[model samples]
Structures are given as structure tokens and as C-alpha cells.
Target: MQAAADQGVEAIRILGVKLINPGDFFELLLRFLFNLIVTVVIIRFLYYPHSRRKDYFFIYMIFSVVVFLVCYSLASVSLQLGFALGLFAIFGILRYRTDTIPIKEMTYLFLMVGISVINSLTDKSVSYAELLFTNLVIIAVTWYLEKIWMQKKEDFMDIRYEKIELILPERRADLIQDIKKRTGLNVYRVSIDRINFMRDTAKIRIFYRQDSNVGPISKEAPKQTPPVDS
Candidate 1:
């Protein structure tokens, strides 16, 4: 009975080890940690500082994690590279179908997906050092472009204006000055989008150099003057 009990205990230990697969689990944990650190650096530190879009911040983080986990699991099953590329294309198209994402946002999304794939699917043939270097390169390039290279970005917003008089071609100078004073934005140019003679209102788009000090403003026009007609 003592020998039989010992054998049972040993069998249970073997079963637990088989179920746990400690080696693969450790590898997954290691890769996931690296992937997460790289993603947060890109999205939280690099992108958020410039764009300041909370919605995209959440989307990018979640997208990166989900993509990483999915790719890693599929890779364990020996999924082909083509399958991963196909998955990337599908997600990209689905994102676009929901809304027309801006070029910059799309680019970031691409980076997140690509980074997830690279980190998760890389085989034993690729050393961990090589993987780390590749991620660093991507992060370095993104940081350079976002912080050092592109300085002086132009932003625009559409506004419904009650002052149809100022929208006239002859009053363009006065119009720009008035908008600047009202909105406190450094308005450089204005374009009349539409005129509503019946309501005495005009839709206008204003362009200005985005000031870092002023921070990110919403796409919706500020209500500095009269209430805009709904």
C-alpha cells in the first residue's frame, strides 16, 4: 500500500508538470513583459505627449496587448507567417471600416500591430538580443520623428459663425482678427465653408499654428462669441 501511494503521488506530480509547461510559460511571460514595456513607451510616453488623445491611448494599449497574446498563442501552434500577415490586414481594414482614422493614428496602429507580431512570433532562430535591438530601433525612430523632427504642426477646426458680414472676401483681414480675438487662437487663415442666408450664419474653417504652450484643443470650435446655430 505504501509503494502504491508513492507511485500515485509521483504520477500526480508528473501530470501537474505536463499541464503547467513551465518552460513555455516562462518564455511567454518574458516576451509579454518585453512587449508591454515597448508598447507603453511608444503609446504613453511618445504618442500621448504629442497628440493627447485619450481615446486613441486606450485603443492602442488594448490593441497591442490583445494582438501580442493572440499572435503568441497561434505561434505556439506553428502558424505560418502568412497567417499573421493576413490577420494584420484584416484588423487594419476593420478599423478603417468603423471610421476614417487620421494618417498619423493609422501609422501608430500599424506600429503597434507590427511590434506585437515581431515580439510574439519570433522563433528560436532570432536571439532575444536581436529582438530587443529591433524594438529599440523602432522606438528611437518614432521618438525622433514625433519630438525632434516635426515641430510646428498646423491644426484646424470648423466653426459655425453668426457674423456673416465678416466672412466676406473684402472683410477677410477683419475676419481673421476677429476670430483670433474671440477664440484666443493664433488664427493664420480662414475658409468659408457654407453660408446660410436664411439663418444669417456661415460655417467657417480656421487654420492656425498649434502652440505647445496652449496644448491640444478639441476639433469642435470654442464658444467664444455668440452661440453657434445647431
Candidate 2:
């Protein structure tokens, strides 16, 4: 009978099933709720409003949950901090399976990962108050940076310029004026790409600020319609 009991214990051990404290489970649940709230505020209010990209809302939510569960599962580790840091370091190099991540989206990805790790790995030494405060600060800073301070500089468009004569180093002002007339944008600045002498055209990148605060500009600018050759 004793041998059978020992075998049963060993079986449970092998299956990684251990008795969990209810208090610890509750704490984890609370942390998950808090993190979800923070993530939603940042994604829905701060990010999506400005970007108008709905795809990342679900992506970030799912990613945060996955990361939180993984971190929570590894709670008994002696080197949990180092392990968590290494795990996020791995996430740092992540490439999107669907498409290449833009700089803004990638930054938000890092933020979501960081917040998930922090919430899931809440150390017993740190008070819940401190964690809440930390999350609030992150949300506030991101909201201010994204929606307020950097709003004016976010819109940009790319266009192809067939007026090779206006693309000269001396004619940069002319190029700016031309872009403003064509696009009806208060162009912040212009970046001239490689000039194709053979094609007699150059790609012009326009960084502009939208005047109204209604919605962001569409991602793709209209393709340049070059003049037809007679």
C-alpha cells in the first residue's frame, strides 16, 4: 500500500501537478485583469484611435495573454527574473508571420510584451499598489506621447515625381511647392529618393502634418501619373 502511494505521488510529480495556493491564484487573476485593462486602454484609446489599424488590437490582446500564462507557469523558478528578461529578449527579434512590422507597431509590440511580463511575474516582495501605479504610469505616458506630443508628426506619404528638373539639389524648394500643390498637404519636409536618369523621374517621400484632428491619412498615397510621351 505504501509503495502504491509513493508511486502515485511520483506520477503527480512527473505530470507537474502540484497543489497551488488559492491566494496565489487569486493574485494572478487580479493581475491579469489589471493588465488586460491597461492593455485595452493603450490599444483602443491611444493606439487605434491614432493609427486606425484594427488588426493589432486582437493581436496584442492575445499576445499579452499568451505571455502572461507562460510567465505565470514559470513562477517557481530560481532565476525567474533572468529567465523573463531572456524570454523578452527573444521576443525582441520577432518578425511578424503575416507582414513586416512597422516601427510604430513594433514599439507597441514591445510595450505589450513588457507589460505582460511585469503583470504575470508579480513578485511577492512588490506590493500590488506599486504594480498598479506602474501600469498607470505606462498608460499615461504612452497616451501623452502618442496622442498629444507626437500627433503632429505622424502622417506621411510617398509619391513618384516625374519632374526630374524640379528634383535637382538647387530646386528642392520648387519640389516642396509642387508637392504641396498636388497633395494639398502642409508638407513638413521632403526626402528625394534615387533619381532615375533613364526614366527621368525620382521617388519623393513627403512627411506632412494633417491639420484636422479627425482621422489619420490613408497609408498609401496616390500613384504618380507621369505625362504620356507623344
Candidate 3:
């Protein structure tokens, strides 16, 4: 009778221990789901539109999803540090031959990875409300910077200027003045290509500022003198 009672107490304690462990299957599923949802949301909403190449956006989405799943699963198993370092090393090698990514896109990738790292290191039972809030803040700030500040300031100001080539012969001073007036930029350097002695014509080329505006100059027809008839 006493032995039976002791066995019952031991059984209850075993069940209690199982309940309190953080490695339970349900808890692992919940953490993975939370991380997966936020990561996908960030990639789709914040990172996709800024990318110039549609193919890159698709690749980014797929890569982020896989990374999130692997990182979350590793976290559940409490092997986060080892996994993170290995993944970092792998990416470092991958970056060597990879095409350049825009700074904005790189920033988004960093944020996504940073969030995954934080999620992996956090306790399983901790409320995910704060995690969700942090993701929202990151996405909002990145979106605002990319759309409102960077694009507006750099759009027209960073024009690619080139040297000008002139195929018509005209007065040098008049041509220079006309170019300045038309482009709103001072010519930095001017090179005279050739002079035709037969036609008394000249070809000139110029190097000018990129942001300077250039357009065709309109000419007014010369007025005819009235005939001085007897």
C-alpha cells in the first residue's frame, strides 16, 4: 500500500517537470510561427518595392523565409550561437562573388537577420507582443527613410553629366553664352574639333556640369526691309 502511494507521487512530479520545460513541441511551434509571420511580412511589405530587379525581390523573399525557419528551429534546440556564426561565415563567402546590392536593400536584409537573432535568443515563454512591436518599428522607419527622404533628395540632384558635342559652326562667344543661358551651367572645358576653311565653319565640343539643364534654342526670323521703290 505505501509503495503504491510513492509511485503515484513520483508519477505526478514527472508530469509537472514535463509541463515546465521550455522545449515542448507546442512552444517550439508557436515561436517558429511568430518569427515566420513577422519575417514574411517585413520582406513583402518593406523590402520588395524598393528593389530595382523583380527577380531579386523574389529571391530575397525565398531566402528570408528559409533562414527564418532554420534559425527559429535552431533556437528551439538551444543551438543559436553556433548556428548563427556558421550562417554568417557562409554568407560572408557567398558575398564575395555576388553582385552588389543597394544600400537600402542591404539594410533591410540586416534588419531581418537581426530580428531573427533576437527572436532566437529570447526565452520561449516570453510574450511576443513586444517582438511584434519591434518589428513594426523597424519596418516603419526603413520605409519612411527609403521613400520620403532618400528618393526625394537624390532623384534629380545626381544627374549623370557628359561632354557636349557641337556639329554646327557658330560664333564662339555667342555659342558659349547661349549654352550657359540654355543649360544654367557654366561650361567647364571646351574643345574645338575642326575648322572648315572652305565653308568658314567650325565644330566645337564642350564638357559641362551634369545637373545643368539643356534644351534647343529657338531662333527668331530676320525681318525683311521694305522696298524703297521710287
Candidate 4:
């Protein structure tokens, strides 16, 4: 009876190993947790602030959740090719009718998705050094592309308009030109806010270009040519 009990115990241990290997399970759990944390961070820092429409945020969050589940499942099972093709077809049919996202924001989304995919496929027992190196590479590439190389100087320029009340017989072309020269922004449109003949002041709004900080405009004036000799 004792021998039989020992055999049963050994068989149970083998069964456990076959059912779910500790290394595989641990790796999956770690990947899931990491993906969740990173997704949350990206949603908070990148997605929530710039997105004006509430529907965009909602859709983005839902997409992230779906991506997480698909990646997790992929790591566990060898999905059939037909199913993968079907997924592609389904995603192709999804239409987002909204304002275009800036390149910077799109890059962040790509990075987040790439990281999730990488983590899902990574082996659990990889050395710490290798893991750290891979992470550093990802960070370095993302920073180089988004912050250093792809960022535009024009985006930093602050262009705003101020509304004023005044009345004049002619358009304020000279004043608008002066403001453009000083602010280095071309005024695109102007609107009349209010006009009170009795007050003798026409409320006007001036749209000008200015840097992010109201400072000396960087635009240089066109050189004046001397009069041609007769």
C-alpha cells in the first residue's frame, strides 16, 4: 500500500508538469502584467490628454484591451492561419471617421503596440542583461524618432489672436502687417466682434502668429533694394 501511494504521488507530479509548466505560466503572467501597466501609462500620458473627442478615448481603450487579449492568447496557442487572416479582414473593416492624429501621437501608439507584442513573445527565462538591453534599444529608438528627429520647430511657435474694440474708415491692413512682422505669424482671418457708432469704437479681433512664448519673432525682414539709377 505504501509503494502504491508513492507511485500515485509521482504520477501526480508528472501530471502537474504536463498540465502547466511553471516557467511558461510565470512568463505569461509577467508578460500580461507588464502589458497592462504599460498600456495604462500610455493611455494616461499620451492618449487621454490630446484627444478632444470622448469617443476617441473610448475606442482607443477598447482597442488596447483587445490587443492585450489577442497577444496573450497568441502566446499560449498556435493560432490557425485562417483565423489570423480573418482577424486582418475584421480590422480592415473597422472605420474611424475622425480628425487625423498627429504623427507624434501615432508614433506613441505604434511603440506601445510593438512593446506589447514583443513582451508577449519573449521567453521568461531570458537573462536580465539581455532584457535590459532590449528595453534600452526600444526606448532609444522611440526617443530618437519622436523627440529628437521627428519633432517640428513650427509646433513650438505660439500663434494666437486678441479681440479689440475699435472703429476705422479703412481696413487695419497696416496694423495687421505690423503685428505679423512683430509676431512672425501670418494673420489668416479677422472678424468684427462689435461696432458701436455712439461709442465710436469698433470691437475687432486680430488673429496673429506668435511663438509659444511671446518673444521677439525669429522671421527676418525682407531686404529693401536701392532705387535703380536712371
What's the CA error at residue 200 for candidate 4, in Å? 34
lDDT of 1 by residue, 41-152 (tens): 9999999987889999999999899999988989967565986889778977887688878788988998999999999999999999999999999999999988877677
TM per prediction: 0.64, 0.69, 0.51, 0.44
The model with the greater lDDT, 2 or 4, is: 2
Which should have the higher TM-score, number 3 or number 4? Answer: 3
Residue 118 in candidate 2 has what lDDT? 89
**Best by the lDDT measure:** 1
Best by TM-score: 2
The C-alpha RMSD in Å for every predicted model, in order, reads 7.5, 7.4, 15.0, 15.2
After TM-score superposition, what is the CA distance of residue 180 in candidate 2 from its true location, in Å?
1.1
**In order, what lDDT does every prediction score?**
0.88, 0.81, 0.59, 0.54
Clashing pairs for model 1 are none
If both were scored by lDDT, which would come out higher, candidate 1 or candidate 2?
1
lDDT score for residue 176 of model 2: 89
Error of 1 at 197 (Å): 25
Ranking by TM-score: 2, 1, 3, 4
Residue 190 accuracy (lDDT) in model 2? 86
Question: Which of the two candidates, 1 or 4, achieves a greater lDDT against the reference?
Answer: 1
For candidate 2, give the lDDT. 0.81
